[model samples]
Target chain A: MRLALLAAAFCALAVPALAQTSRPEPGPLTIAKQGSFFIGGREVKSDTLSTLPNFDAAGTITVDQMYVRYQAPAGQTGVPITLIHGCCLTGKTWETTPDGRMGWDEYFLRQGHPVYVIDQVWRGRSATDPSTINAVRTGKKPVDQLPTVFSAGHEGAWAIFRFGHQYPQVLPGMRFPLAAQAEFWKQMVADSAANLPTPNPTVPALSELAQKIGGTVLMSHSQSGIYPFQTAALSTQGVAGIISIEPAACPDPTADLGPYKAVPILVLFGDYVDEFPRWAPRLKSCRAFAAAVSAAGGKAEVLALPEIGIKGNSHMLMQDDNSLYIADILLRWIGKNVTATR
Target chain B: MRLALLAAAFCALAVPALAQTSRPEPGPLTIAKQGSFFIGGREVKSDTLSTLPNFDAAGTITVDQMYVRYQAPAGQTGVPITLIHGCCLTGKTWETTPDGRMGWDEYFLRQGHPVYVIDQVWRGRSATDPSTINAVRTGKKPVDQLPTVFSAGHEGAWAIFRFGHQYPQVLPGMRFPLAAQAEFWKQMVADSAANLPTPNPTVPALSELAQKIGGTVLMSHSQSGIYPFQTAALSTQGVAGIISIEPAACPDPTADLGPYKAVPILVLFGDYVDEFPRWAPRLKSCRAFAAAVSAAGGKAEVLALPEIGIKGNSHMLMQDDNSLYIADILLRWIGKNVTATR
Candidate 1:
């Protein structure tokens, strides 16, 4: 009877073996320093600055407010990395991944690199003002088009990304780590459609962030890929290196990238380009931009996974099943070109 | 010394242990039918059949050949299943995943279903004459188009699948067995581009294969989705049921689906649909087709994983990490609708 009771207890305990999603016992991680910075502020006499309804007041107005979250291991890799997420997403992109796995934020920290993740002005914790952001030269009675934000559902993504041969037709070799897709979809935020054109505020704010944390490596994803490129050009000495993962857009074709000559850059592209027709032109532009950078004596290396014999990777390489494998590659490259060399 | 040699031998045997990629020890599996069949033959006159240096000699010519590999467990389910792969792929799609994991072929076999995997006529072992296939009148010069076939490279897929947010970006929850990518890529074949507009010979050949193996459930993927639909229309009594995974196109919208009224059908869609723009219309069409089937009194169930609370599945649910999970659902549905009800 005792033995039966013991077996029953064991069975009860083992039946629902839920995967533990919590972090391990606290590691030697310390919050070095974290704060907020304001950029693009101009002193102006505003007619409606007061909290009171449309009351006139004079004060300084800031265009954007930037929030920074920095963490470092006890033993740091002298070279720090500042992670910048794409539009809509916040610093959370670098934190835990959708499927509850350690994200690049934690991965980099464990690798002994001081990590700094930031929410660009008017995003996430930085907050936003819809009226100010959507203000346009409309008419006598101004109308605020709160920036028609759009968010993709599952079907839209499956087709555009070529997750499978096409929607519903998953290929045999796709490696997107799809098990955590629900958690991933949660990360999708409504991005401003208006911001597709320019980078006036975001580029300057991020450049300032880089300058503030001098000698930092800039890692950017998707739409924010241009941040590091523009940042490197604006704050030349502040950035040690740049790693761009499928930048939504490319560096200017006409502009001289000479300032980035001394800075090393790695542009990584994953699988399923031919299936999505839109990617062809974007990739071509990126390739051309990289080629121009090389011509300007800049050490820019474009790593298209297929060309390198690596197959079945999607756009989200960081959260992939072989994420650690790719992360190791990035770390090795960083150690060789930035950390060790420095 | 003798003891040391014994220990050394044991260590050598165990030190570099590798996962067994080979088939498991022989189970109670029996080969029901394994052979080739030729269809569509035309006999030429003796004068035309004689071959000379300058003149063409023609004998009896067969346009299509079909190969079938069938296996059943000792105690087989009365219902058998015929597995067909998508474009540029073969029956291997159901055999093993790109990451060296067991595919539905093995999964269903273990579950006691007699499995029939086929190389659609002209693909894989069912070889066809390219010259004969390309002879169709497409343009002015009778130039052999030979189909402008394309196989998506690694990077192309990474972005399109919403695997990571873009190419090379793997998410945290991706269940794709990525380690076996090399083996997976080997299975990719160049499909016939000319067949896009019409099912023609391929569908007929598949239908014949289904007919040859009576009372078989037809499971089709990608380009092959159309085959089972058309096959059911042609070989109505032969196919007991149909399972379509992201069919490239659906049955003719204009045609009456009354033939499939008695047939049970299940259509499954995976994750990241929002990322792919083309999927919207395609999926809309598929949904419409499935709706039509149901309205016509057919038992058609359309499963969008996310809508059903099963998330992060790419197009390739069979080869996914959670493949078994989806398989279980399919089996349950199969049992409840086909096996049990019957």
Candidate 2:
């Protein structure tokens, strides 16, 4: 079984002397409740015939909704954590890792925090209307009017995800499980959110989720790193705390920092930022943002894993070999900073 | 909570006198192992620039794969069941009902069967390449070359899914939980399987899954009802049993029944088939197919729920209020007909 193989590999790495012994069986997960729901979608009515071959599109339909799946422990202790995935991925990003390791969602749940994972609008389980694209193909709409839909190729993702500087090349000391590279590629999906509104539908949907859940910690990664800040800017009604991991963009230092001042913030970066051309600038921008927050009488800690004696982390720090080690660091931060609001 | 609302409604219908009392809490599920994996995809090599704004597509990418999520009970006993969703839906169809009730996946798991729910190729968690569409949008490919991607409209799906004769017209005594109509509409998605080769990539992928798991009972619904037959025709390597629920099309009655002769087959139809124009012919075709299979020395049963005194079921029989009642029928059949293979 795949689990057996993973257990063996894990034991060889963690306890070489005890590698020969069989791994202990994992206990069943206990949870008080688990379910899914949609949030912040609006109905769009169309009168024209749809792009579907045999169907007429003369009815109301919902679009731009975010899908949230939640699991709460039997005796919850920590504040609820809402996880927003980056580009080209879905809630699966926080699930079982590429190499079958327990992902952050389960890890956090086991650590007593109710975890809510979301698939941003227009991606994964969150559906998007493709009528425009179909209209373009049918000449009902001009090609120029076609929405921007793109998929990340393996090579591009390899470089951008910081797996290596080039395709098929593993970075030295990188903690990514390269043996499961194929599985990682499976996580790549066609991202259609580029065609959404200026602030993106996900921003409003996330804001609505925060308010709906009363108060919760918002954790984001990569392309979605700025969502929590933007959500706070719109209205910090239920935004209790913010954790941005390896964000591709940070808020402009010149922008008003009032919305973020009251919220505890953590901007985290993995290793190889200084060595990777693309990530180095991102890290610098976040550092400036953190400084701006501090100048505005706010608390913001910009953390680089290497500075904390944690090494060999990639852009996908949560999925790396030392993922739980990083998670422990995050747990400690949450315990100290984030108030139990949920 | 949504669960509380659903529980209250459920109690009102089941036991009117007891509706005043709070519904008992659902006990935690005991799952042995749960995870997801991709199956039956191939590397697609491209030498041209990708449709992405900043990325080159000059590399290998995976497509036409199926995503499967599995959960096994703590002490599994029954044969594994592979649940394939109908058209315009995803694996979410088997997770939680539109009205927030326990889905068939959990019900089957509780019945001691490992449940494997799949997002068919080009749908849900299964990733599809958008390069061709992007090519057309960017003028790199002709509009005619664009893939046939279509999304079902609310009105169209309403009639087709047999929710009613027309939009907003519920069939008398239908069990589709009309109150959650909005939630059901959310299940509609853009289906891109038309872009794939004949027989669809999901056929081979599902067959491959059966083989990989050694053997499994293939339970398919609506559009996917024929997949089990098609998969078996290709190779019955891992197919132990077949349960086709309201298939739009059935295997050709005249086709070779060699592969199906040994496999126990159950073709089930929900209520309103004889009265609904669209479903009337489909039921006829499946009845013919079942008769043909029987004539060819195969065990095939064509079941109409009304005939068995189980009435008021819709096309989405599994999500209906009496869904578990239907599932119980299935469990009894499996107990008698399906031999444990995994």
Candidate 3:
């Protein structure tokens, strides 16, 4: 009966339409009977990663599009997990160092988890990647890829003082520090050299990818974790649990995190980082935020940072001196925390 | 022309496979058009938790799925970050206990990461949920799920004596003690209930789930993190990064843990956990395994337990004291390390 219905539907619409990433809504639409994708003369073997992108182009984006890989046990199939990098960072940082394979990447690899490293717009390898902002500057390397503000009247102190650079862009409020931009570029080159993919909202792109990987979990560091939080909150079928490491920025829920459903979430960190005086406010903010997640029924907790002297105060817990200590907390969190309860 | 093609394809096939995770593979006789999944569906969409075993199963099994209710955002996009609970505790412990939320979930949720929670197998609300492992047991609660034994006949005093669990059959060699299984279960169920999932190769199931989540990261703790390791090592596709904290067991890679691909990985623990006298060999083995992964171009790291007494020996880092410290470390690592490099 199923086959007959499909065949009839096919026969009714003898011709198909040409579409790509963008689409428009029409009256009385039937997604079920809509044209399915097929490459070449033969029918598409599967929604293989290669073919799925074309699908995302067919309509609006979906949460299932992201392609994080997963392998399952007999009764326990795994879902996909995503790794979003922080500001100016590529996704690969979640794995190894710039040289090749490092400690953390190897840990995940050994444990058997996939890592999707993406460069956010204007950072890392993505310095040249395309986005709504960069679409206009569509030229070659740095020149075309650099933010428009750089060329405009927003030249930084370094640019103005050093090379006699001038920001006569004739626009107000566009100026930013050249140091900040330089910092951004530095992170990008490192990530790019190491083959890390830049993180982007690229939700539509992910929807196609999701079909390829079994399930996905969003893992973000610094600013990237924010991507997953936003992703999950926006769609009905978004990411699963998130392993956020000093992820900056997230929206608070009016209701609470509980309704993201009963996701098996685990929020962890090093004590040394939290105790540092420099990050007290951030710590307070983080704690209050995590508390909200917990109040709504999701699991959230912060680990204490090492003593100030034990590991340098540094910018964050995982960074600076006691690097290994931070890794331990994250690895352990993944090992013991995330799982399906009876 | 595109519309024509779609009409032609649609006319031939009706009732398009709605929400099919993947298309079935054609017979071998059929030539493959696309080369492979490389460079196709690549997105940062980490997903977690699902009732259905595979991604392709268009039918979603709500029994085991997390039920989420999206709420308005207190801030930006309303995309909140939630946390999932592990083996023994409730979400409440994380936010309002002697410690605090540490901003683990709420931090991101507030910045846009809404916290979510999950009950472990045979523990908390999950135990009562008929769809989860709780249904497999045989008792008023009917203990359904069981643990995965890498060692065949490795029994301990707990299995045979303390909990007094009788096995249908033990593996070939390696017996701990008659009390092995019994004691292990007893310890597992201290605050939580005793339950574990049956062990299997796990590759296929995990792969299927990954496809659904669009491939996300798995941030786990204790024994559960092992599953992520297993999945990442053998996944058909690459997974994102995996964060494990205080894993119950670090199986020797030589014993398993397949390829060193996917994304980045981090394995960590407190100095005490690293010094865990009982499993020195395992920890050593983990280090060696991580080293091996690093050599293979995967990032892997080992973080020993916290040195200072502030955060002492404890299985659950996020749950106990020093929660804030731990959260900071996570934020730092993800931002600095993972983002800095691949």
CA error at residue A254 for candidate 2, angstroms: 2.8
For candidate 2, lDDT tens digit of each residue in B1-342? Answer: 523533442332333212322334568777777777888777776643255556676666777878888878888889999999988778888877888887888889888899999999888778878777767766788887767776777877887878889888998878888898888777767777667787989999999999988889999998899999999999988898999999989888998889988799998888988888889999999888888988888888777776655667899988888787778777877887888665
Q: DockQ for each of the predicted structures, in order?
A: 0.01, 0.47, 0.01
lDDT by residue for model 3 over B1-342, one digit each (tens)?
Answer: 524532442232222223111223221111101000001111111121112231111111111212111111233322222233343333322332222123243333333222333233222221111222212221222221212111111122112111123233422221222232221221121121222334322223344444444433445565455656766655634244566665655556665445443355666564333333544554566678677777766667665533212224244455433444555445444443332110
Instruction: Give each model's whole-structure lDDT.
Output: 0.58, 0.81, 0.34
Pick by DockQ: which candidate is best? 2
Fraction of the true interface contacts (Cα pairs closer than 8 Å across chains) found in each model? 0.00, 0.51, 0.00
Every model's TM-score: 0.43, 0.91, 0.31
TM score of chain A per candidate = 0.78, 0.91, 0.50
Q: Give the TM-score comparing model 3 with the true structure, all chains together.
A: 0.31
Which residue ranges in model 2 land beyond 4 Å of their true spot? A1-25, A47-52, A57-59, B1-25, B47-52
Q: What residue pairs clash in candidate 2, if any at all?
A: B50-B57
Candidate 1, after superposition: displacement of residue B252 in Å? 64
Off by over 4 Å in 1: A1-62, A132-146, A165-169, A193-197, A339-342, B1-342
Model 3 score (lDDT): 0.34
lDDT digits (tens) for residues B1-342 of candidate 1: 523532442232222112212344433223222212233222222222111222123222222444455545545675788788875555667865656456687678768787777666545434333222112221222223222333333444454334565555676656566665444444543343343336556667666665666677788886677778887777676777888887777776558787677788887777766566745565678778877887777777666666544566776668877777677667766876774222
CAPRI docking class of candidate 1? incorrect
- Best lDDT among the predictions, by candidate number: 2
Ranking by DockQ: 2, 3, 1
